[model samples]
Each structure stands twice: as C-alpha cells, then as structure tokens.
Target: MTTAQAKTFITLFLAMLLTSCMVADSTPDNQWRIVDEGAYAADVSADAQLSVVSGINNGIHVWRFGEAQPLFQWSHQSEGGDQSNNLVANVHISADSLFAVTADREAFAIWSLTSGEPIGFWRIDESSIRDVAVSDNGRGVLVGRSNGKVMFFEPESGRRIEFLGHQERINSVDITPNGRYALTGGNDYVAYLWNTDSGQVIHTFTHPSRVTLVALDDEGRYAFTADSQQKSQIWNVQTGEPISQLQYIARQKIFTDAVFSKDGKYLLTGAPSRRLYLWEVATGKQVGEWKVAPRENMSPPSAVVYGVGFIDDKHVLSVSSSGLAELWSMP
Candidate 1:
C-alpha cells in the first residue's frame, strides 16, 4: 500500500480501537439504538457510509448512514410478487459506497449506487447464492455458491475467477479489510482462505461439524471459524495454525455469524440463542455476552443475530433473523 493508504488504514484502525474503549451502555436496553426493523438481511459498509436492508416483500433498500428512509429500493414483480418473500436475499455494499450487490436464490446483480442502475446481472452457479462480499477495494466481488464453489469478479474487466475446495454448500465468505484475502466456510465442514486476486487457496481449516461461518480481522492476520455444532476456533492467517479453541457457554449448536474487532483484540460470535458472545483474542476466553432481543416480549423471541459487523470499536451493528437492526454499545 502507498503511504497514503497505509496512513488511512492506520487512522481508521486507531479510531476503532478508541471506540472499543467507549463508556456506554452497561446493558442492552440502556445503551443500544435500534436503527431498523422488519428486514430479513442487512449489512453496514466498512466505512459505515451506507447500509443495505433486505425485506421479504419490499425487495432491497440502500440508505445513508443517518437516514431512516432508503435512498433507493428494488423488488421483483412476477407471480403477483408473492414469491418476492422467498426471493429476498443477501446484500453487499462496497466500503466506498460506489456499488451494491444483491443476491437471491436465482441471481445476484451489481448496481451502481451513484447511477441507481444495475451494472452487471448474472447467476453465480446452478444452485443458490449462499453468501456474497465485496473486497475492501470496492472493485472485486467475492461470492460463495450453494454448490460450495467461490467466485471472484471484477466489474471493469468482467473477469470471473473460480475456486473449488468445499464439497457442500458454502455458508459464508468474508474479505479482509485490505482486500488481499477471502475467507470462507461451508457445510462441507471446512473453512478456506483464498488469495482474492489469484483465487488460490491459501489455507484450509477443517472442523468436526459443518462449517457455518468464517470471518477475518481487518488486517487479515487472524481468521475465525465456527461449525454447525458448538465448535469455534481461531487461526493464524499467515501460518494456518490453530491459535486456540474458543470456549464459551453457548446454548445453540449452530453459530450464524462472527466478526473480529478492527484492532484484532476481540472477537464476537452470534448464534440462534439470541445472544452475541465476546471473546478475548489472546486467551480465547469468553469475556462478555449480550442478549440480542430488544425487549422482554417472548412471543417466539428467540431470534438469531444473523448478520453482524463492527461499526466502530465501541459499537456494533447487527441484524436479527426477524429483521430488526440495532446499533449496540460494546462492552
């Protein structure tokens, strides 16, 4: 990276670290801000400039950092829009807020946020698109297929780089903040890290159960992996060594999402238990746990924290399976 780029990253890194030290809510109800609700999926950009919200019947929405209403929305119009509920899928927005990608069971399309029109529209594989992520560079797109193959795309070059490793459906794929590496986990019980540019396998971590989610820290130095069972481990990205087995009092066997703090000092894991667990990266010890539910209403309230990302070191943004979005204060 150039000096400017390095400095920029360093500045952002420090900002995240400082945020982790924030003196905010000691409890969920006291210190959290609910940003959205009634959405199936949502993701915040790396820079937190925009948020992508997916709905069962309303299609997709892109909103600015502080806006309550979306700047744009898109939906399907076939079969009286009934299947639109099932058609709603994952959404990814570039850190620079220049492009957005929305994926459903059938196809995933690229849209120019500035132009408010699609730039690329195509299917990834014979099966559904399980997960999608945009490289930090905002130009490369990484997609995991339900068939277990991962594809890398460049909008300008129209280059599709494919990597084959897993045997079952890929559950999640995450790009390092520097955009140098891609980490993936699948139902095949394996997690693989790929060189984003070359589409080459860098490291493969095998688990005892089906791999459900994988995440990389901002600098790509560490990767987190979780399986369908209550198993989670941290790996050294550079050496492919298992750093430690993350031990926690997890009520659910299936973990849905995981993310590392920007400083790489802490890790967060979420599951169907309607809670997020924070672990100390150095010791692999559970340091904190927070329930994800917004209130005490227990009418089928065991919602999973399906999508999670660090908005800053001190705050986190998460989307529950029931479609509620909240900006939560970190401990």
Candidate 2:
C-alpha cells in the first residue's frame, strides 16, 4: 500500500476503537457520576435543592444543581456539644427548610436551608432513632426509634407526641402528603399504618421478611415496602391489604430499598448486586433495569445499598455502603 493510504487506514481504525470504548463505558456501569464522596451518607432528599446528611461528619450538606461546591453545610457540632460521634440517620429538605436526626439515640434537629442556621432541636426517647419523616404541611416531623417507638413533634414548638405499637426497631417511616396518615416498618417484618391525629394504629400488614424501607405515595393511597427477605410489596393504605408484590431478581439476592413515583404509577427497587429495577405498579411488570459500578475503593459484595429516592418521575438518587452518592437518570 502507498504510505498516504496506510496512514489514513490507521487513523480510521484508531477512531473506531476509541468510539467503541466510549460506547461500552457509557453503559449503566459508568452513567452515574459521583455527587459526593469520602463521607458515609445516611439519607438524601431534594426539594428546591439537594440535601445530604453524612454520618462520618454528622453534618448536613446542601447542593444546588450546577454549582461546583455545596451551597452550605450544617453540622451537629454547630449546635454546641461533642456530637461528632453521632450518626445522622436521615436528612430532609422541605419548602426551603432542612431537618436531620443525630445517631446519639435521642436528638433531632431542624435547620434553615437559606441561612444554614440551626432552627430548633429536640430529644425523643432514649432509643436510637432509625428513621425520620417530615409532614407535608411542614409543621410536623415524625421520628422512629430503634425500640419501635415513633414520636411526632411540632417543629416550631418542639412538642413531642408518642405513637405506640410495633415491638421491634423501626427501620423506616413515611407520612402521607396530606399529613393524615403514616406508615412505619421495622425488624418485626410488619408495617403499621397510623392515624396522625389520634396516634393510633389503624391497620397493619405483615411481610415474610424484615421490612427495611417504606414509602407513601404522593396521594396517600398506597404504601410501598422493601424487605430484607428479597421482595417489595405495595399495600392499599386504607384497606391494609397488599395489592401487589415483586419478587427479587434471583441473582441479585438483597433488595435494599423501594420508592414509588410521584404519581404512584411506578415503583423502583435497589438491589445488592448494584442493579436498579423499575416496576409498573398495576401490571407488576419489570419495565427497566440499570446497574451501578462499585467505586474504586469499595468491594462489590459488601457495597450493599440502604437508600433510594426519586429525584423526579424519571430519575433517582442512590447511596451505597462505600459512601458514594450519585444521581441516575431513568430511561
């Protein structure tokens, strides 16, 4: 071949190779870019802004999309005292406000999103708090403890109201959009629906496995639960009946968490094998799947996830054991 022709051929071949590499890496394995790293992120929520609570620093960090650095950070130590060792179980942002619970076993705090100043703090029971959910009206917050006790507090007044019933450590709690009902799950392999006004258990549903996570639909008609025994179930909020259940994909093994779309038409689950599954609510059909690659310093098997939240109808934010948090856009 002529020299000029040989040179052109090599250039074309290299270009194709590079394009192929880009396509391969562009798959689910690399689609998620790290939003935060180095700290053990416990909970994440988004409203007008994105918020993350890190157990390592016992701090709440806020990020506005398009900004290179966090807009601000609020830490437990800022409230005065040595709370560095406390683990933050959850962090939430609502109507420009932020709330977080410290792992010190009894305290929860509120903050102002705009100013990053501590607004108020309260102490619940002596048991470690496992989960927290803020009411839709932004007036109340529910705190779930390791002893299966749930406390409702008026954020402004710091008044505490107790709800009793579950016999094991409460793992998850979610309130309805109208602030009338709440669903809580725990180690007892059951979920209880409570009337917010009366603080009474109105209904209960049992699962074959430990219910690790729970989420209420935007309309308050349905409650979704993810269990450790490899399944996710949707319950009719009023009837206390499970209307549908999705078995875990056999190869994946562990089902970490589940969340419903804002419209309640779809459900999403995160698996231990670094896979995310999307299911149709009515038909119980698997609609989509995406895989997440383990971070560099993290081992695959031990990188189990415990948190998943919808960024919108078409995207989700997930956190893994390696403290890597990323946002995934859905298909």
* Alpha carbon lDDT at 61, candidate 1: 71
Whole-model Cα lDDT of every candidate shown, in order: 0.71, 0.65
Clashing pairs in 1: 19-314, 20-313, 20-314, 39-323
Stretches of candidate 1 exceeding 4 Å from the true structure: 1-37, 47-49, 76-86, 95-98, 112-117, 177-180, 294-298
Model 2 per-residue lDDT tens digits across residues 1-331: 9999999999999898777433121143222322444344445443323545453533555555334567666665434566654556465444223443333456777665556666667666488878777765466778888888888777666566788888889988887655667888889898888887788888887878778878777666778887776567787877887778764344324565666776778877766666667888886677767655564565433444545667676677666544555567777
Q: Score residue 166 of candidate 2 by CA lDDT.
A: 83
Using lDDT, give the best candidate's number: 1
Model 1 lowest lDDT segment of ten: 25-34
Q: Which stretches of candidate 2 lie over 4 Å from their true place?
A: 1-37, 46-49, 55-58, 94-104, 249-255, 271-273, 300-307, 311-314, 321-325
Clashes of each: 4, 0
lDDT of 1 by residue, 1-331 (tens): 9999999999999899778644332244322222334556666665555667776446677766555566787653333434533465677766556777777777677777786777766654477788887754457788888888888777778877788877889998887655668888888888998887787888989998888878777666788888877778899989999887787544435666676776888887766667777888888987776666642354755666666666777877666655555566777
The TM-scores, one per candidate, come to: 0.78, 0.78
